[model samples]
Target chain A: MRSSVIIFPGSNCDRDMDVALKKFGFKNQMVWHNDQSIPKSDLIVLPGGFSYGDYLRCGSIASKSKIIKSVIDFANSGGLVLGICNGFQILTETGLLNGILQQNKFLNFICSNVYVKVKDKQNKYFKDLKKDLLELHIAHNEGNYFCSDDELKSLEDNSQIAVTYCGVDGTENEKTNPNGAIKNIAGIFNKNKNILGMMPHPERMIDKYLSGEDGSLFFKNILDNFK
Target chain B: MKIKVIVTLKNGVLDPQGKAIQQTLNGMNFGNVEDVRQGKYFEIEVKEKDEKKAKSLVDDMCKKLLANLVIEDYKIV
Candidate 1:
């Protein structure tokens, strides 16, 4: 599958996503944020990192990038988009996603391996991946996912809530959730269910037996979805 | 000609930065800290001399990129 990853000035995870896409057998290209056109691609991935030094707000400045307008158009045209970490914040800022990345309620930046509970396995991004426990690293200060009550209710009702933080036994606790994100959310899908934004760095854990390669399934899921 | 645009979060949207600023003011014993909502000041110097056209263009810029209509508002002065 063809994919493009957007690289903003301060995006540190662009290469990590490039490496992950290479593993997925995709002809991946890195698009600069200032470019007004998006490469013709099946999937667009917005990598993580402190875009524009996370200044003003995490994704505020990056969302105004010229390429982001095309990304928004791509989403409107039904193309798949995935935003990780700062990428997630950009999606919200651009109105592609339905929430904002508020300051972590704990008033601290969290950087560690976190355990996530998969809520859906039917989506293209989660195919071959069972609704099971996943260990991934999350690093960000503005990782808090905030939405209006009505929007959250709609997402929950539509089964768009994709991933949540929880213990190994399946119970969600505030402590293990790390950022005190509402409903322990680590990720979510857009209204069309094609776009996804998550805080955990799946690209950071793609090697099995080492990080158990849990992140590999995410790419595999996308590659095999072309059918 | 110069026009200033101030953009701020709309009511009910949480402004943590504004809250922090307000807290600092309260700590400083500023009795007149009625409210504090953080906003951006965009100092625009447009070559257009028509006041009507300048106001309209500035408003368009604010709508398109300066402010997020969903959760924020902007004023041109």
Candidate 2:
């Protein structure tokens, strides 16, 4: 499948994403953030990193980059966009996705692999995967996601709440909730429901036994519906 | 005229950095801290002397790039 990843000046995960995509058997193009166009692809990923040195706020400045206009247009056209870590923040800042990403409630940088339970499998991204539980690595200092009460209710009511932080035993992990998200949400999808933005790095856990390959299926689920 | 631009998080918005600083200061025994919120400042010296035009430029800069406007609010003083 054709794939592309956007790279901003401070993006440190660009290479990691490229390697992950390659390991997934897809050779993808790395699109620069300044380009005012989205390269044709089945998937577009905004990888994790401190874009624009996290100036002003996490993912705030990068949202106004030249290429964001195109990304917004792309998402409006029903295109698939996945924002990981800072990418998730950027998406929110750009208003391509709902809510705002604030700093972790703990006032510290969390670098541990996090467990995420799939809250919704009715969508193509996780349609085949059982909605029981899954695991992915989350590395971020500003991963706390917040939205207005009404908007939070709408997100839940529509099953757009894709993933939440949970212990390996299938219970919510309060300490690891990190940012005290409204409902331990680690990832979410837009109203259009096609675009997804998540803080956990599925790309970091796609290898079998190594990362248990639990996250690889997330990609396969996408490939299944796309190609 | 020199104008000070103050950018701050909106009400009810979480400010982790601000909270951290507040705790640090309080821990050092600095009392009388009511509330704390983080903000940014931009001291711009502009060539345009017309208040209307300078104000318009600053607004445009904030709207087009300087500010996210989604979660941040900025004012020129």
Which is the leading candidate under DockQ?
2
Candidate 2 per-residue lDDT, tens place, A1-227, comes to 88889999899888888888777677699999888787787778888999989987788888888988888888888888889998999898888888977778887788887788888877768877744777788888888888888889999889899889988887886765766776898999998677889998888887776876767777767777776
User: Isolated chain A: TM-score per model?
Assistant: 0.96, 0.95
Q: lDDT for each of the candidates? A: 0.85, 0.82
What are the per-model DockQ values? 0.24, 0.54
- TM-score for candidate 2: 0.91
TM-score of chain A of 1: 0.96
- How much does each candidate deviate from the true structure in C-alpha RMSD? 3.0, 2.1
lDDT of 2 by residue, B1-77 (tens): 45558888888887777888888888888877757899989887777879888888888877755665656788987
User: Residue A209 in candidate 2 has what lDDT?
Assistant: 67
Cα error of candidate 2 at position A33, Å: 2.1
What TM-score would chain B receive for each of the candidates shown? 0.88, 0.86
Docking class of 2: medium
